[model samples]
Target: LDAFLDAEDVLKVEGRLSRSSFPNSFKHPTVIPPGHHVTNLIIAHYHETVKHQGKGFTINEIRSDGYWICGLSRAVATHIRHCVTCRRVRRPVESQRMSDLPVERAEPTRPFTYCGMECFGPFWTKQGRKQEKRYGLLLTCFCSRAIHIEMLEDLSTDTFINGLICFIALRGAELDMNRLNVFLTEKQCDFVMNAPHASHAGGVWERQIRTVRSVLNATLLLSPDHCATMAIVNSRPLTADALDGHNRLEPLTPNHLITMKSTPALPPPGKFEREDLYGRKRWRQVQYLTEQFGSRWKREYLHSITTRQCWHSTKRNLQVGDIVM
Candidate 1:
């Protein structure tokens, strides 16, 4: 008993007797042990003492006061999880998982019929021994995993609108794509705006941004002279085959339209043939690309649906106007 007191300060001096007092809260703080004869009663007392703080705050207070019982965190969490007062005052959040992907995302559809877009970067480049800033806008096709990149000078709304117009014009001519307005109003397409701070909502475009950044970083390191697809298309001179003239990268650029237009993959062993009709082959690649897209999409969607991680069981939630504190 003497050893325990010397070892810890769970009990603090208070006149003739010692009482529970955590350091952070000087207010009437008491530590509750689970095995006490009046364990429930003591918890109820402390809960009221702290004015019904949430599980984390209450647990912190317990720790602060140097009073701990076995499973203290679990006890506080369970207590708050069931507290009617807290439940009523605080809105209960339910994990209402979305009701499956729409047909455009799940079923095979036109490449850009459903797409996700994002803008990132002010990528630094050494131009004539001076650093320059530039931003990239990425458009990811929901169904095909195809990407179109647009370089932007800034993030102004006007700049974005202009980039969109240019992208739309180029794609409109090549793919016979419909207007963005008509696609949503007449074709049942959607243009979703991801809620702020909810990055998961933009997973499609977010992943592509990460991938493009990594690839570009690596490519730049290995081949600083390499030209971007857009640069070549816009007729910038002297683009020496992006991956350093290495034969290892030939497998990724099997078609001229895709090759001349840009790159993919880490290449392979041996020489590979470039398909006839570079311009048409770019569009033709979509034929096989759709199968690969569907296969990958289905595999991922199945994995996502098979598990209920964390909040597997439902608990009784608080009612409206429940007393708190």
Candidate 2:
């Protein structure tokens, strides 16, 4: 590489190459400069540290006595320390507590489940406007960690019941719905029982929603629409350290969670095979959807419609005779 650079006249030579035998005005070919040599040496040292140490070392460690070569200087050291890949791989200092005690347990018989809804908003398309607010409900079986997502429009009793009914019908063959011991949700009256299955409470689902909010806020930086959509759409389907009781879960995309149920559950022995299996499943789903629905399914199913309702009656319902106030 050095020879090629020299041949191509890319590298500029500086300093004296050799001393002449006779006293002549002609200067000898210049040798490589100290600064350039030092730069190369420092870069080499950085590479060696990264290669041998496995985990990267700091600038101070590179400059320490045994590893230090004569050519390396503070300036060159600083340059190598700013290397982008090295910076990415470097371990940050542990500034916070490493561990904490577990919180007190709730009643054991209370089965874990996640219940929430998401709105599929208007996505930009070549044709025209699309459905901006298709309210959808999600029911997650916490123990089995299965998810069911269904799209709906209004949040009325009929809409909620229809969505739940569709979900139950889909899972009827696979899951024993009666075995579902608890239903969880936030204080949404739809989730809280008005008539049948009157025991349903919002507590568990409320807590789960809070947890989803917290995780999304912490990871995605709390952009409202993205975070809310992600929290509902990506529940329990994907494995995560946060959800799986691990230190750091892999970041999951919404598409991954949505399409997981359509794929097979067999575990591959190796990472390569697992990835290949996932890819095959994804391609197959795309093919099946395309063949079954044709190309215009997006156009047909995703039309935009809006509605407005008054909240006067809703507000009046809250006005009651109070013991205090």
Most lDDT-accurate candidate? 1
TM-score of each: 0.47, 0.24
User: Quick one: best TM-score, which candidate?
Assistant: 1
**Model 2 off-target regions past 4 Å?**
1-127, 142-147, 173-203, 210-325
Please report, in order, the local distance difference test score of every candidate based on alpha carbons. Answer: 0.53, 0.37
In terms of lDDT, model 1 sits at: 0.53
Model 2 lDDT at residue 165: 64
Per-residue lDDT of 319 in model 1: 69
| Regions more than 4 Å wrong, model 1 | 1-41, 44-78, 82-98, 173-191, 220-325
